[model samples]
Target: EADIYQTPRYLVIGTGKKITLECSQTMGHDKMYWYQQDPGMELHLIHYSYGVNSTEKGDLSSESTVSRIRTEHFPLTLESARPSHTSQYLCASTKATQETQYFGPGTRLLVL
Candidate 1:
Protein backbone atom coordinates (compact mmCIF):
# COMPACT_ATOMS: atom_id res chain seq x y z
CA GLU A 1 0.00 0.00 0.00
CA ALA A 2 2.99 2.29 -0.61
CA ASP A 3 3.63 2.31 3.15
CA ILE A 4 1.26 5.25 3.75
CA TYR A 5 -2.47 5.83 4.28
CA GLN A 6 -4.54 9.04 4.29
CA THR A 7 -8.22 9.04 5.17
CA PRO A 8 -11.05 11.21 3.86
CA ARG A 9 -9.28 11.43 0.51
CA TYR A 10 -11.55 14.42 -0.01
CA LEU A 11 -13.40 16.63 2.48
CA VAL A 12 -15.80 19.59 2.46
CA ILE A 13 -16.68 21.24 5.75
CA GLY A 14 -18.37 24.33 7.13
CA THR A 15 -15.97 26.99 8.26
CA GLY A 16 -14.75 27.25 11.89
CA LYS A 17 -14.90 23.58 12.80
CA LYS A 18 -12.05 21.49 14.11
CA ILE A 19 -10.54 19.00 11.73
CA THR A 20 -7.83 16.41 11.94
CA LEU A 21 -6.23 14.63 8.98
CA GLU A 22 -4.65 11.25 9.52
CA CYS A 23 -1.39 9.88 8.11
CA SER A 24 0.20 6.50 8.74
CA GLN A 25 3.17 4.62 7.38
CA THR A 26 4.50 1.10 7.86
CA MET A 27 8.07 1.58 6.63
CA GLY A 28 9.19 2.64 10.09
CA HIS A 29 11.18 5.64 8.89
CA ASP A 30 12.46 8.15 11.43
CA LYS A 31 11.53 11.24 9.40
CA MET A 32 8.01 12.33 8.58
CA TYR A 33 6.37 15.50 7.18
CA TRP A 34 3.10 17.25 6.38
CA TYR A 35 2.58 19.76 3.57
CA GLN A 36 -0.15 22.03 2.24
CA GLN A 37 -0.80 22.74 -1.41
CA ASP A 38 -3.44 23.93 -3.83
CA PRO A 39 -4.82 22.13 -6.91
CA GLY A 40 -1.47 22.62 -8.57
CA MET A 41 -0.06 23.62 -5.24
CA GLU A 42 3.60 23.58 -4.48
CA LEU A 43 4.67 21.55 -1.48
CA HIS A 44 4.91 23.70 1.64
CA LEU A 45 6.25 22.05 4.75
CA ILE A 46 3.59 22.40 7.40
CA HIS A 47 5.01 19.97 9.95
CA TYR A 48 7.59 17.23 10.51
CA SER A 49 9.34 14.94 12.97
CA TYR A 50 12.91 13.66 13.25
CA GLY A 51 12.18 10.64 15.45
CA VAL A 52 10.12 9.40 18.37
CA ASN A 53 9.11 12.41 20.45
CA SER A 54 11.28 14.61 18.23
CA THR A 55 9.19 17.00 16.21
CA GLU A 56 10.23 20.25 14.56
CA LYS A 57 8.76 22.79 12.18
CA GLY A 58 10.06 23.11 8.66
CA ASP A 59 11.03 26.34 6.87
CA LEU A 60 9.43 25.66 3.48
CA SER A 61 6.24 24.36 5.11
CA SER A 62 3.79 26.48 7.04
CA GLU A 63 3.17 26.33 10.80
CA SER A 64 0.96 23.26 10.87
CA THR A 65 1.57 20.41 13.33
CA VAL A 66 2.91 16.83 13.69
CA SER A 67 3.81 14.17 16.25
CA ARG A 68 6.02 11.05 16.21
CA ILE A 69 5.31 8.93 19.29
CA ARG A 70 4.85 6.10 16.80
CA THR A 71 7.29 6.16 13.88
CA GLU A 72 4.65 4.99 11.39
CA HIS A 73 2.05 7.68 11.92
CA PHE A 74 1.85 11.48 11.60
CA PRO A 75 -1.47 13.29 11.94
CA LEU A 76 -2.31 17.02 11.58
CA THR A 77 -5.19 18.81 13.20
CA LEU A 78 -6.50 22.33 12.60
CA GLU A 79 -8.02 23.97 15.65
CA SER A 80 -10.46 25.94 13.55
CA ALA A 81 -11.25 25.34 9.95
CA ARG A 82 -11.27 28.34 7.65
CA PRO A 83 -11.75 28.96 3.95
CA SER A 84 -8.00 29.48 3.88
CA HIS A 85 -7.52 26.01 5.32
CA THR A 86 -8.83 24.61 2.07
CA SER A 87 -5.85 22.93 0.50
CA GLN A 88 -4.21 19.58 -0.12
CA TYR A 89 -2.38 17.82 2.72
CA LEU A 90 0.42 15.54 1.68
CA CYS A 91 2.51 13.26 3.89
CA ALA A 92 6.05 12.25 3.18
CA SER A 93 9.10 10.55 4.64
CA THR A 94 12.75 9.80 3.89
CA LYS A 95 15.28 7.39 5.24
CA ALA A 96 17.90 8.49 7.75
CA THR A 97 20.60 8.40 5.08
CA GLN A 98 18.48 9.32 2.05
CA GLU A 99 16.99 12.73 1.43
CA THR A 100 14.66 11.47 -1.30
CA GLN A 101 11.12 11.54 0.06
CA TYR A 102 8.05 9.42 -0.65
CA PHE A 103 4.66 11.16 -0.88
CA GLY A 104 1.05 10.14 -0.37
CA PRO A 105 -1.67 10.73 -2.96
CA GLY A 106 -2.93 13.54 -0.70
CA THR A 107 -6.11 14.57 1.07
CA ARG A 108 -8.22 17.28 -0.54
CA LEU A 109 -9.78 19.66 2.00
CA LEU A 110 -12.33 22.39 1.31
CA VAL A 111 -13.61 24.74 3.98
CA LEU A 112 -16.70 26.64 3.05
Candidate 2:
Protein backbone atom coordinates (compact mmCIF):
# COMPACT_ATOMS: atom_id res chain seq x y z
CA GLU A 1 0.00 0.00 0.00
CA ALA A 2 1.02 3.62 -0.53
CA ASP A 3 1.79 6.08 2.24
CA ILE A 4 -1.61 7.69 1.94
CA TYR A 5 -5.29 6.77 1.39
CA GLN A 6 -8.39 8.61 0.14
CA THR A 7 -11.91 7.30 0.28
CA PRO A 8 -14.80 7.50 -2.19
CA ARG A 9 -12.62 7.45 -5.27
CA TYR A 10 -15.48 9.21 -7.05
CA LEU A 11 -18.37 11.27 -5.79
CA VAL A 12 -21.45 12.80 -7.45
CA ILE A 13 -23.35 15.24 -5.30
CA GLY A 14 -26.16 17.76 -5.52
CA THR A 15 -25.81 21.53 -5.70
CA GLY A 16 -25.49 22.05 -1.97
CA LYS A 17 -24.41 19.33 0.41
CA LYS A 18 -21.88 18.65 3.10
CA ILE A 19 -18.97 16.44 2.17
CA THR A 20 -15.52 15.54 3.35
CA LEU A 21 -12.68 13.94 1.47
CA GLU A 22 -10.77 11.59 3.72
CA CYS A 23 -7.01 11.37 3.71
CA SER A 24 -4.60 9.50 5.93
CA GLN A 25 -0.96 8.57 6.08
CA THR A 26 0.90 6.00 8.13
CA MET A 27 4.41 7.21 7.44
CA GLY A 28 4.32 9.43 10.52
CA HIS A 29 5.36 12.33 8.37
CA ASP A 30 5.25 15.72 10.01
CA LYS A 31 4.54 17.52 6.74
CA MET A 32 1.20 16.99 5.07
CA TYR A 33 -0.38 18.68 2.07
CA TRP A 34 -3.62 18.84 0.11
CA TYR A 35 -3.68 19.59 -3.57
CA GLN A 36 -6.39 20.29 -6.14
CA GLN A 37 -5.56 19.04 -9.57
CA ASP A 38 -7.06 18.35 -12.96
CA PRO A 39 -6.38 15.39 -15.24
CA GLY A 40 -3.56 17.04 -17.19
CA MET A 41 -2.09 19.76 -15.02
CA GLU A 42 0.44 20.36 -12.33
CA LEU A 43 -0.48 19.89 -8.72
CA HIS A 44 -1.55 23.00 -6.83
CA LEU A 45 -0.91 23.25 -3.15
CA ILE A 46 -4.19 24.09 -1.49
CA HIS A 47 -3.11 23.53 2.09
CA TYR A 48 -0.13 22.38 4.08
CA SER A 49 1.02 21.85 7.62
CA TYR A 50 4.51 21.68 8.98
CA GLY A 51 3.44 19.80 12.05
CA VAL A 52 0.72 19.42 14.58
CA ASN A 53 -1.09 22.70 15.21
CA SER A 54 0.95 24.32 12.48
CA THR A 55 -1.42 24.66 9.59
CA GLU A 56 -0.51 27.33 7.08
CA LYS A 57 -2.30 28.38 3.94
CA GLY A 58 -0.22 27.80 0.87
CA ASP A 59 0.48 30.43 -1.76
CA LEU A 60 -2.04 28.87 -4.09
CA SER A 61 -4.07 27.35 -1.29
CA SER A 62 -7.36 29.05 -1.59
CA GLU A 63 -10.88 28.32 -2.83
CA SER A 64 -10.60 25.38 -0.40
CA THR A 65 -9.65 24.66 3.15
CA VAL A 66 -8.12 21.88 5.22
CA SER A 67 -7.48 20.89 8.79
CA ARG A 68 -4.66 19.14 10.60
CA ILE A 69 -5.72 17.66 13.88
CA ARG A 70 -3.97 14.33 14.08
CA THR A 71 -0.47 13.63 12.95
CA GLU A 72 -1.61 10.87 10.62
CA HIS A 73 -4.86 12.39 9.45
CA PHE A 74 -5.65 15.52 7.46
CA PRO A 75 -9.12 15.80 6.00
CA LEU A 76 -10.70 18.42 3.72
CA THR A 77 -14.28 19.46 4.20
CA LEU A 78 -16.70 21.47 2.10
CA GLU A 79 -19.53 23.16 3.94
CA SER A 80 -21.58 23.47 0.79
CA ALA A 81 -20.30 21.76 -2.26
CA ARG A 82 -21.13 23.34 -5.59
CA PRO A 83 -20.69 22.46 -9.25
CA SER A 84 -17.70 24.77 -9.30
CA HIS A 85 -16.07 22.60 -6.64
CA THR A 86 -15.90 19.61 -8.92
CA SER A 87 -12.33 18.52 -9.31
CA GLN A 88 -9.80 15.92 -8.29
CA TYR A 89 -8.58 16.23 -4.73
CA LEU A 90 -5.24 14.69 -3.94
CA CYS A 91 -3.68 14.05 -0.55
CA ALA A 92 0.04 14.00 -0.11
CA SER A 93 2.59 13.88 2.69
CA THR A 94 6.31 14.28 2.96
CA LYS A 95 8.62 12.81 5.53
CA ALA A 96 11.09 15.66 5.38
CA THR A 97 12.35 18.51 3.34
CA GLN A 98 13.86 17.74 -0.06
CA GLU A 99 12.03 14.44 0.02
CA THR A 100 9.60 13.04 -2.49
CA GLN A 101 5.92 13.41 -1.73
CA TYR A 102 3.55 10.46 -1.80
CA PHE A 103 0.12 11.10 -3.29
CA GLY A 104 -3.14 9.29 -2.82
CA PRO A 105 -5.27 7.98 -5.68
CA GLY A 106 -7.51 11.05 -5.24
CA THR A 107 -11.26 11.61 -5.12
CA ARG A 108 -12.99 12.66 -8.33
CA LEU A 109 -15.94 14.85 -7.46
CA LEU A 110 -18.85 15.82 -9.71
CA VAL A 111 -21.40 18.27 -8.41
CA LEU A 112 -24.75 18.61 -10.12
Candidate 3:
Protein backbone atom coordinates (compact mmCIF):
# COMPACT_ATOMS: atom_id res chain seq x y z
CA GLU A 1 0.00 0.00 0.00
CA ALA A 2 1.08 3.57 -0.60
CA ASP A 3 2.17 5.39 2.54
CA ILE A 4 1.36 8.95 1.50
CA TYR A 5 -0.01 11.28 4.19
CA GLN A 6 -1.40 14.81 4.68
CA THR A 7 -1.58 16.62 8.01
CA PRO A 8 -4.48 18.56 9.53
CA ARG A 9 -7.06 16.93 7.31
CA TYR A 10 -9.17 20.03 7.97
CA LEU A 11 -8.26 23.64 8.73
CA VAL A 12 -10.06 26.90 9.40
CA ILE A 13 -8.07 30.08 9.25
CA GLY A 14 -8.64 33.80 9.08
CA THR A 15 -7.57 35.78 6.08
CA GLY A 16 -3.90 36.71 5.70
CA LYS A 17 -2.66 33.87 7.84
CA LYS A 18 0.18 31.87 6.38
CA ILE A 19 -0.29 28.11 6.38
CA THR A 20 1.49 25.06 5.16
CA LEU A 21 -0.15 21.83 4.16
CA GLU A 22 2.17 18.93 4.75
CA CYS A 23 2.43 15.98 2.44
CA SER A 24 4.73 13.01 2.73
CA GLN A 25 5.17 9.61 1.16
CA THR A 26 7.18 6.56 2.15
CA MET A 27 7.27 4.75 -1.20
CA GLY A 28 10.27 6.77 -2.38
CA HIS A 29 8.46 8.16 -5.37
CA ASP A 30 10.53 10.68 -7.27
CA LYS A 31 7.65 12.58 -8.79
CA MET A 32 5.28 14.49 -6.53
CA TYR A 33 2.42 16.80 -7.36
CA TRP A 34 -0.13 19.14 -5.79
CA TYR A 35 -3.60 19.59 -7.15
CA GLN A 36 -6.52 21.91 -6.36
CA GLN A 37 -10.10 20.88 -6.56
CA ASP A 38 -13.58 21.75 -5.43
CA PRO A 39 -16.12 19.26 -4.21
CA GLY A 40 -17.30 16.93 -7.00
CA MET A 41 -15.19 18.70 -9.58
CA GLU A 42 -12.17 17.91 -11.73
CA LEU A 43 -8.76 18.37 -10.17
CA HIS A 44 -6.40 21.05 -11.44
CA LEU A 45 -2.70 20.40 -11.18
CA ILE A 46 -1.06 23.41 -9.53
CA HIS A 47 2.48 22.29 -8.80
CA TYR A 48 4.83 19.36 -9.28
CA SER A 49 8.36 18.16 -8.83
CA TYR A 50 10.32 15.57 -10.73
CA GLY A 51 12.82 14.97 -7.96
CA VAL A 52 14.96 16.65 -5.37
CA ASN A 53 15.80 20.25 -6.35
CA SER A 54 13.46 20.08 -9.33
CA THR A 55 10.16 21.85 -8.94
CA GLU A 56 7.74 23.42 -11.41
CA LYS A 57 4.45 25.24 -11.50
CA GLY A 58 1.59 23.40 -13.11
CA ASP A 59 -1.01 24.44 -15.66
CA LEU A 60 -3.39 26.17 -13.29
CA SER A 61 -2.95 29.53 -11.66
CA SER A 62 -2.49 29.32 -7.91
CA GLU A 63 -1.34 31.37 -4.95
CA SER A 64 0.25 28.31 -3.36
CA THR A 65 3.87 27.22 -3.53
CA VAL A 66 5.62 23.89 -3.15
CA SER A 67 9.11 22.59 -2.58
CA ARG A 68 10.82 19.28 -3.22
CA ILE A 69 14.02 18.97 -1.22
CA ARG A 70 13.57 15.25 -0.49
CA THR A 71 12.37 12.43 -2.70
CA GLU A 72 9.44 11.53 -0.47
CA HIS A 73 8.16 14.89 0.73
CA PHE A 74 6.35 17.69 -1.08
CA PRO A 75 4.74 20.38 1.03
CA LEU A 76 2.46 23.18 -0.22
CA THR A 77 2.26 26.59 1.36
CA LEU A 78 0.08 29.66 1.11
CA GLU A 79 1.83 32.83 2.16
CA SER A 80 -1.37 34.67 2.86
CA ALA A 81 -4.61 32.84 3.21
CA ARG A 82 -7.85 34.20 1.80
CA PRO A 83 -11.46 33.19 1.50
CA SER A 84 -10.88 32.74 -2.20
CA HIS A 85 -8.31 30.05 -1.40
CA THR A 86 -10.77 27.74 0.22
CA SER A 87 -10.69 24.32 -1.39
CA GLN A 88 -9.37 20.82 -1.15
CA TYR A 89 -5.71 20.24 -1.92
CA LEU A 90 -4.59 16.80 -2.92
CA CYS A 91 -1.05 15.48 -3.11
CA ALA A 92 0.10 12.61 -5.27
CA SER A 93 3.29 10.82 -6.12
CA THR A 94 4.56 8.40 -8.71
CA LYS A 95 7.75 6.50 -9.30
CA ALA A 96 10.05 7.78 -12.02
CA THR A 97 9.25 4.74 -14.13
CA GLN A 98 5.62 4.30 -13.20
CA GLU A 99 2.53 5.99 -14.60
CA THR A 100 0.29 5.16 -11.66
CA GLN A 101 -0.07 7.84 -9.00
CA TYR A 102 -0.66 7.40 -5.28
CA PHE A 103 -2.65 10.12 -3.54
CA GLY A 104 -2.85 11.31 0.03
CA PRO A 105 -6.14 11.65 1.88
CA GLY A 106 -6.20 15.40 1.02
CA THR A 107 -6.27 18.61 3.06
CA ARG A 108 -9.40 20.70 3.29
CA LEU A 109 -8.74 24.39 3.86
CA LEU A 110 -11.26 27.02 4.83
CA VAL A 111 -10.16 30.63 4.83
CA LEU A 112 -12.64 32.60 6.87
Candidate 4:
Protein backbone atom coordinates (compact mmCIF):
# COMPACT_ATOMS: atom_id res chain seq x y z
CA GLU A 1 0.00 0.00 0.00
CA ALA A 2 1.10 3.55 -0.66
CA ASP A 3 1.93 5.73 2.34
CA ILE A 4 0.00 8.68 0.97
CA TYR A 5 -3.53 9.72 1.99
CA GLN A 6 -6.08 12.16 0.55
CA THR A 7 -9.19 13.32 2.30
CA PRO A 8 -12.74 13.52 0.93
CA ARG A 9 -12.24 11.05 -1.90
CA TYR A 10 -14.96 12.94 -3.77
CA LEU A 11 -16.46 16.38 -3.53
CA VAL A 12 -19.15 18.45 -5.22
CA ILE A 13 -19.56 22.13 -4.64
CA GLY A 14 -21.21 25.13 -6.19
CA THR A 15 -19.26 27.63 -8.20
CA GLY A 16 -17.30 30.25 -6.23
CA LYS A 17 -16.94 28.00 -3.19
CA LYS A 18 -13.59 27.48 -1.56
CA ILE A 19 -12.04 24.07 -1.15
CA THR A 20 -8.90 22.54 0.17
CA LEU A 21 -7.55 19.17 -0.94
CA GLU A 22 -5.43 17.38 1.58
CA CYS A 23 -2.44 15.17 0.72
CA SER A 24 -0.14 13.45 3.12
CA GLN A 25 2.57 10.83 2.95
CA THR A 26 4.32 8.84 5.64
CA MET A 27 7.27 7.78 3.47
CA GLY A 28 9.31 10.83 4.44
CA HIS A 29 10.17 11.63 0.85
CA ASP A 30 11.70 15.00 0.15
CA LYS A 31 10.02 15.34 -3.24
CA MET A 32 6.26 15.74 -3.47
CA TYR A 33 4.02 16.68 -6.39
CA TRP A 34 0.42 17.57 -7.22
CA TYR A 35 -1.11 16.51 -10.49
CA GLN A 36 -4.39 17.38 -12.17
CA GLN A 37 -6.19 14.90 -14.36
CA ASP A 38 -9.58 14.61 -15.90
CA PRO A 39 -11.39 11.34 -16.34
CA GLY A 40 -9.66 9.30 -19.04
CA MET A 41 -7.16 12.10 -19.58
CA GLU A 42 -3.44 12.39 -19.05
CA LEU A 43 -2.18 13.63 -15.73
CA HIS A 44 -0.60 17.07 -15.66
CA LEU A 45 1.88 18.20 -13.06
CA ILE A 46 0.54 21.40 -11.46
CA HIS A 47 2.80 21.96 -8.51
CA TYR A 48 5.76 20.46 -6.67
CA SER A 49 7.93 20.80 -3.65
CA TYR A 50 11.48 19.60 -3.23
CA GLY A 51 11.57 19.81 0.57
CA VAL A 52 10.40 21.85 3.48
CA ASN A 53 10.09 25.53 2.53
CA SER A 54 10.68 24.75 -1.14
CA THR A 55 8.02 24.90 -3.84
CA GLU A 56 7.69 25.52 -7.57
CA LYS A 57 4.88 26.01 -10.02
CA GLY A 58 4.60 23.33 -12.67
CA ASP A 59 3.96 23.38 -16.39
CA LEU A 60 0.20 23.64 -16.03
CA SER A 61 -1.48 26.85 -15.05
CA SER A 62 -3.62 26.28 -11.97
CA GLU A 63 -5.68 28.46 -9.68
CA SER A 64 -4.83 26.16 -6.81
CA THR A 65 -1.85 26.55 -4.50
CA VAL A 66 0.22 24.12 -2.44
CA SER A 67 2.48 24.16 0.55
CA ARG A 68 5.06 21.78 2.00
CA ILE A 69 5.52 22.43 5.67
CA ARG A 70 6.38 19.09 7.26
CA THR A 71 8.10 16.54 5.06
CA GLU A 72 5.19 14.13 5.43
CA HIS A 73 2.47 16.56 4.43
CA PHE A 74 1.64 18.64 1.38
CA PRO A 75 -1.80 20.17 1.08
CA LEU A 76 -3.41 22.04 -1.86
CA THR A 77 -5.94 24.83 -1.65
CA LEU A 78 -8.28 26.50 -4.07
CA GLU A 79 -9.29 29.98 -3.09
CA SER A 80 -12.35 29.98 -5.31
CA ALA A 81 -13.72 26.93 -6.99
CA ARG A 82 -15.06 27.08 -10.52
CA PRO A 83 -16.49 24.75 -13.09
CA SER A 84 -13.22 24.69 -14.98
CA HIS A 85 -11.50 23.53 -11.83
CA THR A 86 -13.26 20.19 -11.82
CA SER A 87 -10.66 17.47 -12.03
CA GLN A 88 -9.04 14.64 -10.15
CA TYR A 89 -6.21 15.81 -7.97
CA LEU A 90 -3.45 13.32 -7.44
CA CYS A 91 -0.63 13.54 -4.99
CA ALA A 92 2.64 11.70 -5.39
CA SER A 93 5.96 11.34 -3.66
CA THR A 94 9.41 10.00 -4.49
CA LYS A 95 12.75 9.84 -2.84
CA ALA A 96 15.46 12.26 -3.90
CA THR A 97 17.60 9.47 -5.33
CA GLN A 98 14.79 7.33 -6.72
CA GLU A 99 12.54 7.92 -9.70
CA THR A 100 9.70 5.61 -8.70
CA GLN A 101 6.72 7.67 -7.59
CA TYR A 102 4.03 6.45 -5.21
CA PHE A 103 0.63 8.01 -5.87
CA GLY A 104 -2.23 8.67 -3.52
CA PRO A 105 -5.84 7.85 -4.24
CA GLY A 106 -7.05 10.92 -6.10
CA THR A 107 -9.57 13.48 -4.93
CA ARG A 108 -12.33 13.96 -7.46
CA LEU A 109 -13.94 17.38 -7.48
CA LEU A 110 -16.95 18.66 -9.34
CA VAL A 111 -18.14 22.22 -9.56
CA LEU A 112 -21.70 23.17 -10.34
lDDT of 3 by residue, 1-112 (tens): 8899999799999999999999999998899999999987999999999999999999999989888888878999999999999999999999866689989999999999
The whole-model C-alpha lDDT of candidate 3 against the native structure comes to 0.93
Worst 10 residues of 3 by lDDT: 94-103
| TM-score to true structure, per model | 0.89, 0.92, 0.96, 0.96
Q: Estimate the overall C-alpha local distance difference test score of candidate 4.
A: 0.93
Clashes of each: 2, 0, 0, 0
The CA-based lDDT of model 2 is what?
A: 0.87
Q: CA lDDT of each candidate?
A: 0.82, 0.87, 0.93, 0.93
Candidate 3 residues lying further than 4 Å off, grouped into runs, are none
Q: State the lDDT of candidate 1 residue by residue for 1-112, as single tens digits.
A: 4677888799999988888888888887888888888888577887788888988887664535666778888888887888988889998887876667888879999999
TM-score for model 1?
0.89
Candidate 4 segments whose C-alpha is farther than 4 A from its true place? none
Model 4 per-residue lDDT tens digits across residues 14-110: 9999899999999889999999999889999999999999999999999899998899999999999999999999999998756799999999999
Ranking 1 against 2 by TM-score, winner: 2
- Cα deviation at 53, candidate 3, in Å, is 0.8
- Model 4 TM-score (2 dp): 0.96
